[model samples]
Target: MQIGYFLSCEEYAPESLIQQARWAEEAGFESLWISDHFHPWTDEQGQSPFVWSMIGAISQVTSLPVTTAVTCPTVRIHPAIVAQAAATSAVLTEGRFILGIGSGEALNEHVTGARWPATGTRLDMLRESVEVMRALWQGDFVDHHGEHYTVENARLYTLPDTPPPVYVSAFGDKAATLAGEIGDGLVTIPPDADLIRTFRDSGGAGKPVHAGYKVCWGPDAAACVSTVRSMWPNDALPGELAQQLSSPKHFEQAGQLVTEQMIDESVACGDDVDRHLDAFRPYVEAGVDVVHVDQMGGKRQGSELEGFFAFYRDEMLPRMRELAG
Candidate 1:
């Protein structure tokens, strides 16, 4: 399994993200996953820079290959545009980029003043969007009229020798089957063996399966749990609410239901090396090809950030790599 660092666009500024990418590379992380979001989940987290610009900057600073943890190209942006941006990103990174995409959430898509479609419609739109992107990436003028999108005479002038791989993100069996059929890889957050099985059984065999796990590394476990509960309570929000919620305020309201015990049970908090490894073991055992770790505390900088990376480099990463071997 490849080890990676997840760049939280919602939590960090552009420069801080780039710096963290450098730190991740220096700490022996093999790749990077950056979240693409139009808004932060809560007022507390408080930052959401345009992801493509940050990716361009990241390409300049690090040799590590990067992927968006998941970008929703079906609604806020046309897939044709996403194809162009992704193609350019591939060129900028010298073909070290993967485009991870999903059906999208209301919070980002609703900003375009477009009506939020039902889940089935969104998935259908996502399928058509992928088709549109793939057609544009062929470097020919594309004319497509699908149920959800229309592209007329669109051609991506700039593209890498090989188009970046498109990884589909899924949280349920139906979506996993879609990922299996259409994606070069699969991207999901949890370590669900059943989900993995569904993907493979539905034709995703031998494809990369990627997941992200959040961790808060510090001296105090309780403090870290409190910070996670305050900053990322939305993570614990159940079901399709994450996709349907239209704003940060709604998320904040829903997050009120997330208890400290839930946060403690779900996330890896504090500096226990064994516990950190245990948090990741589920994904590894579930056959994830790559696991991206997102550090959950506030601006990870100075000694705090440095210490976390150092610990991973010296203690955690080696053991994880050995387990992978």
Candidate 2:
């Protein structure tokens, strides 16, 4: 098992993200998972840089392999375009890039004034989009007109020698099955063992499985919880609400329902190495091959980011590695 760092594009600026990638490597992180977002969940979070640009920047600073924790290509951009961007990223990173994708949330994809499709339709779009991307990656002009998307003789001129692996992110059983059917790998953040099993049963056997979670570390546990509570109440928003909520305002409205206690109970907060270890045990038990973690509110040095890197480098990461054993 390997431990990677997650770069949350929703909360930090591009330069800070690049710095964190370097810091993550210095802190002993083996790989990187970067969130791809067009908007922050709350206005208070206040930042959303274009992910492709950030990936290019990160590639220059760190040798760590990078994956988009999840990018949704179905609505906001054409798959042909996403394929080209990903191809360039792979080349920039020297083939150290993995395209992690999913049926995305409306909060990010609805900005183009498009009606958000239902979950089933969105998943269908995701499948077709992946198909289109893979075909384009084959270095040929591709023409595709499908149920949910269209491509007009598009081709990826810049390509990697070996196509970058596409990892599908899924939460539901049907989605998990689809991940197994099409994905080169699987991405699950919550450590739902049943979903991993579903993926394996549905032709995903032996594919790499990746998992991740978020934590806040600081001098005071209460302060940490409060910090996470303010920026990430969306963590507790139940059901398909995460995927269905169309805007930051809708999310902020729904976020009102999340209680501070909910954040404390679910997240690994504060400096307690044990609490952080407890948060990671589930993923290790679920047989995950790689587990990436994000530290919230870390945009600067000697701030939340510094404290988090210190704790993980000195305590959490080493212990987690042993536990994974």
Q: After superposition, how far is residue 115 of candidate 1 from its true place, in Å?
A: 0.8
Error of 1 at 194 (Å): 0.9
Question: Relative to the unseen true structure, what is the C-alpha lDDT of residue 306 in candidate 2, on a scale of 0 to 100?
Answer: 83
Worst 10 residues of 2 by lDDT: 296-305
Give the residue spans of candidate 2 off by over 4 A: 299-302
**Over the stretch 1-325, how does candidate 2's per-residue lDDT look in tens digits?**
9999999988998888899899999999999999988999988688999999999999999999999989998999888889999999999999999999999998889999988998889988999999999999999889998988888878788999989999999999999999999999999888999999999999999999999999988878887778877888888888888888877888888888888899889999888989999999999889899999998866422387888898999999889999998
Model 2 lDDT at residue 265:
95
Task: Go through the candidates in order and give the clash count of each.
Answer: 0, 0
**Candidate 1, pairs of clashing residues:** none
